[model samples]
Structure formats: C-alpha cells, structure tokens
Target chain A: MENLLDKKQSIIESALELVHANGFHGCPVSQVAKNAGVAAGTIYTYFENKEDLIVGIYDYVAEKITSYIAERDDDSLEFENRFFNYWRNFTEFYEQHPAIHGFYDQFLNSPFNSEKVQNRPNMWHEWAHMFFQSGMDEGAIRATNPVILSILVNTNITSTVRIKKNFKTKLAKTNVNLDEISQLIWAGIKTA
Target chain B: MENLLDKKQSIIESALELVHANGFHGCPVSQVAKNAGVAAGTIYTYFENKEDLIVGIYDYVAEKITSYIAERDDDSLEFENRFFNYWRNFTEFYEQHPAIHGFYDQFLNSPFNSEKVQNRPNMWHEWAHMFFQSGMDEGAIRATNPVILSILVNTNITSTVRIKKNFKTKLAKTNVNLDEISQLIWAGIKTA
Candidate 1:
C-alpha cells in the first residue's frame, strides 16, 4: 500500500522533471518511466496516457505553486507587501527549478489543452481574484471589474517571470523592479 | 521583371497561407512550392531557403501591420475615439488573416531567429509608443514608462485575440463586451 502511494508521487515528480527538461510535446512517456526508475507498465498503472501524464504534472505544479502563494499571510502587512510577496514567491519557486519554468512555459498554452487541463482550473487564480477584491475594498486598487484587472496583472507576472528566466546576462537590463513594480502597476488602479 | 515580381509575390502569399494553416515548422518547402503553383526550383529563384522564405513573410506582415498603425493621424478626435479607432484597425487587420495572427502568436514567445527577423524591428511599435507617450504627456495616461506600458497594453490585446482564436466557445462565457473591455484597458492605463 505504501509502495503504491510512493509510485504515484514518483510518477508526478518524474513527469514534471522530464517535461520541464524537454518541452511538453518533446518529452515522451517511455523516457519519463525510465527516469522514474520504474517500468513503462508502471507508468500505465498510474496514468492512462501521455496526455494524462502531462495534465497530472500541470495539476501538481499548480497545486505546489498555489501553496507557496497562499502561504504568505500577514494581515497587518499593507496590500503592497502581500502583493509583492506573491510575485517573490512566484519568481523564487521557478528560480529554484528553472526547468519547471520551462515546463510552465511550454504547456500553459491552450494548444496543449486536454480535458484534465480544462477542468482543473488554476487554484492560484481564485485566490488572486479575492486579493484583487480586497485591494479594491481597501482602497488600494480602483473600483472596476476585477476579472480583467486580475487577468492582466497575472499575465504581466507570467511575462516578467518568463522574460527573467530567459535573460542571459547578470546586468539589470530587465524592466520590472521586484518591489517597486508592484506600486507602479497599482498606481493606475489606486484611488483618484 | 514585373512578371517576376508578381510571381514572387504570389509565392510569398501562398507560403503565408500554408505556414499559417500548418505551422512554420510543420510545413515543408515542397508543399509551399506546390501550394504556390510554381515548380520547386522556381521557389529557389526568389528565396534562398525555407528560413529566408519565413523571414520574408514575417517582414511583409510586419510592414503591413506597422504601416497601418503608422498611418493613423486622427489627432482631431478625443483620446477615447482615437484609441477605439486604433483598436478597430488593429483587430480588424488581425481578424482579416488568421495566418498573420498565427505567425505573431506562434513566434511571440520564441521567434525564429534570422538576420532579417533580428534586424527588422516593428516600426508600429515606435508609432504606438509615441502615441501612448503623447497621451501621457497630455495627462491622458498614467505616468508610466511608455514603451513598457504599450507592451502591456498590446499584450492584453494580442492575448485576447489569441484566446478568442484558440478557445472560441469558452471566451464567450467571459461575457466580454470587447468595446467595454478595450475601454477598460485604456482606462486602466489612462489618467483619471
């Protein structure tokens, strides 16, 4: 029984590693199984097919990312601190495993869509919508439809992370300030 | 010589149709030549190879998009109307040809690097930046870096178009009044 659970976790971790190294389409099931130190049949026992494996990796990554994002809880901290914390957490996780950044980059597009991908909505997004609402109510953000605002903000974060990961130099050429960029972004949405 | 130019233009148009229908990588030279209704050798006459052909198409698309963006001189109109006119032109052109949009969508992340693609910067970007800067200077837009702000604004527009193209039915659920959405985006960037 313990073996079954271990194997299940192993499969997900292996899929993440493999998919991140090779792109979503480039990685294959056989390679994942081999890297996991399990037989190809063992992978089949855990996942139905390649699509299932990829989606499972996405779910696992999403869950892991959300946990990191939601972990920052300082009610006393200004919305700015909490907000920057989210970006910091986001950048830190991907920084730790640059490959995971690659994984997210290659698979997040809808071109790689599947039923599991469709159904397992990004848990982090829900928390973000709540954060935007709180910002609005707290007069930290403007009163407007939070949907577009949240989507646009998150897209920028994704864009920043992507651009940062791709930057080859040590120079401070990247545009966004880790701390101040948050203020600049909210400056538009802040009270009149 | 004029007849040669017509044939070359026809070949490029045909290549665009095929590459957009398939993908830059998925389509083959033989297929492009066949689709262009020219002998395989005739393709070599105008372009060096597949890479050259792809870059040529990209340049043509960029010129067309940027030229359209550059020609908007409706300074007599209010900011709102001016913004809408620009959006209308951009989106209409984007909608006219899925292939052009596809080219941008596919390459936005990792464009095929060529001397031509590298050297050929988007002139439309300059005009758009100046437009945004003008708005900022007139106290119409929030004081942010004009270039980055334009990138952010363009990100939303292109991403929305990509979403609509990719998930036709799902986006309908967003209840997005595009005009309102466009206004909202402009409003977010604009000074109150």
Candidate 2:
C-alpha cells in the first residue's frame, strides 16, 4: 500500500512537470505517465481523471507546505521575524520547485476555483490566518483585517513567483531586489 | 483597409468566444476561424498563429478596459469619492465580461505574464500610487511605502474578482460587503 502511494505521488509530480511546461490544455496524460516511469493505467488508478490529477497536485503541495509551517516554533520569534522567515522559506521552497508555482496559479484560475476543496482544516489556510491574527493582536502587524492581510502576503509571494518565472531577469538588472518586495509589504502592514 | 480591420476584429472576438469556452490551448485557429465565419486562411492573414491571436485579444481587451477608466472624469471629485467611483466603475466593467476575466487570469498565470504588454498607461496603478503619496502628504493615509499600498489595493481588487467570479454567493453570506472590503482597505492605510 505504501509503495502504491509512492508510485501515485511520483506520477502526479511528473504530471506537474508536463502540465507546467506545456499548459493545462497543452499537456497529455500519456506523457505524464511516461515521465513518471509508470503506466497509463497507474495514472488512472490514482486519479479519476485529468481534472482530479491537476487539483490533487495542488492539495498535496498545500498540505505539505502548511504542515511544514505549522511545525515551526514561530511563536518564539517577533511577528515580523516569524513572517519573514516563513515568506523566505515558502518562496525559496517554491522557487526551487517551479512546477508547484505552475500548479498553484493553475488551480486558482481553473474550474477548481469553484470547487471547495476542504481548505479550512488544511494547514496552509488556517495556520497562516492564525499567524496573521496573532501578529495583529500583538500590535506588531497592522490592525487591518488579518484575513485580508494574509491574502495580501500570499498574493505578493506567489505573484512575484509568477512574475519572476514568467519574465527574464530585467527587473534584477534594474535593481529590483526580490527581498525588498516582501519588506515593502511588511513595512506597509507593520504597526510602526 | 477599414473593412479589413472590422472583419479582423470580429474574427478576434470570435476567437475570444471559442478560447473562453474551451480553455486557451483546447481551442485551435481552425475552430476560431470557423466560429468567426471566416476562412482558416483568412485568420492567418490577420494573425501569425495561436499565440499571436491570444496576445491580440488580450491587448484589445486590456486597452479597452483601461481606456474606459481613463476617459472618466475623476479630477474634480474628492479623493474618497473619486476612489469609490473608480472602484465601483471598474468592478462593474470587469463583471460584465467573463471572457476578459478568463483571458486575464490565464494570461497573468501563464509564461505569457510579461509579453511586453504595451501596458496602456494603466490609470489604476498611477491612481493608487498617487493616492498613497498624496494621503501621506495630507496626513491621511499612513507613512508607509506607497508601492506596498498599491499591492494591497491589487490584492483587494484581484481577490475580490477571484472570489466574486469563482466562489459563488457564499462569500456574501459571511457579511464581507464590498463597502466593508473597501473600508477595511481604506482603514488600513488611513492615519489614526
């Protein structure tokens, strides 16, 4: 059973590669199976269909990221410090695995946008929301709606990922530091 | 030449219909042409290829939206009133066109994010930046970085669009009125 789960996950990650490279509509399942070093039947065994495969990748990654963040002792640190570390770790992790960025944006714009995929108990949404609310209560972060604040932070990080992955290094040449991107957000939302 | 331009635009509009209906990559030039009531060869005369056709539609739609906001007279109104009118008008305009929304999110998320979009002197960007700066000057909005404020507005507007279109009516059931969303954003930036 464990081996079957591993094989299924491997196939899904491989599908992410093809999906991001070509596009949601451009990639084929046969190639995804080939890339995963699995058979097409194995792909079907894991996912009911291509749509399920696409959203499954998102859920899988979201769960992993949230779990990682939740395990951290962020409460020991200052609010900004905790958020900074989380943002750095989150962005770096996704940057290393560019395919995840592809799926994240894809899920947002896809029909899955309409699908309510058990997001509440999910580590990503719930934990992040609490973290921001904690910051707000501690007077470290602005008293703006923490939910909206969290949303802003997520958009900044992910949109930067989207922008950086999409364009050439033109912004870098113009001294557009990516770190400042977060700091700018942090500054705007800070209670100083 | 005038007749050709009208026919070409109609073809592109038809392409938008097909692309929106069947995701971008799912639709082909031949299908677009057939839907447009034009010959496949005629499409090639107007567009270089599928990517080009997609790009053309985006440029057309983006420019139209920007121009609508641009042609408005907000100069005489007070800042708050002006901002509200612009926000209301922008949302109304955006809500009217699902194709534009589809094309936009797909375009933003795709590797086509930059595409040297000839950015239409986006009044919205300029307005927000100025709003931040002027508010700080007048001792109204906070002393934070205007750039981040711009991002907050973006997060608010885009997420609102994302939810409004994607999330069905459940979002409103929670009591996050558009007016309150606007106020939450305004309060975040406003001076105490």
Best by TM-score: 2
Residue lDDT tens for model 1, B30-107: 887787788889988999987688777877787788777667658777766777787777887787777788766655
Error of 2 at B53 (Å): 2.6
Please estimate how well model 1 matches the true structure, expressed as its whole-model Cα lDDT.
0.67
Steric clash pairs (candidate 2): none
Report chain B TM per candidate.
Answer: 0.82, 0.76
Indicate the TM-score of model 1. 0.67
DockQ of each: 0.17, 0.21
Q: A1-192, model 1: which lDDT tens digit per residue?
A: 268878877878878777665455445778777778888888888888876777777777777877777786565787766777766777787788676676766565434544456555668667777777787788876675566566556665666565455443543453434344444555555665
Off by over 4 Å in 2: A116-121, A136-148, A164-168, A187-192, B1-7, B17-22, B25-49, B69-93, B96-98, B111-157, B163-168, B173-192
For candidate 2 chain A, the 10 contiguous residues with the lowest summed lDDT are A167-176
Model 2 iRMSD vs. native: 6.0
**TM-score, one value per model:** 0.67, 0.71
Per-residue accuracy of model 2 over B1-192 as CA lDDT, tens digit each: 359988888887887777666666557878887878888999889888777888788778766766676567365555666566656766677788777766766675665544454354655456566755775776765576565555556555666666566545544353234445565556555665
lDDT of each: 0.67, 0.69
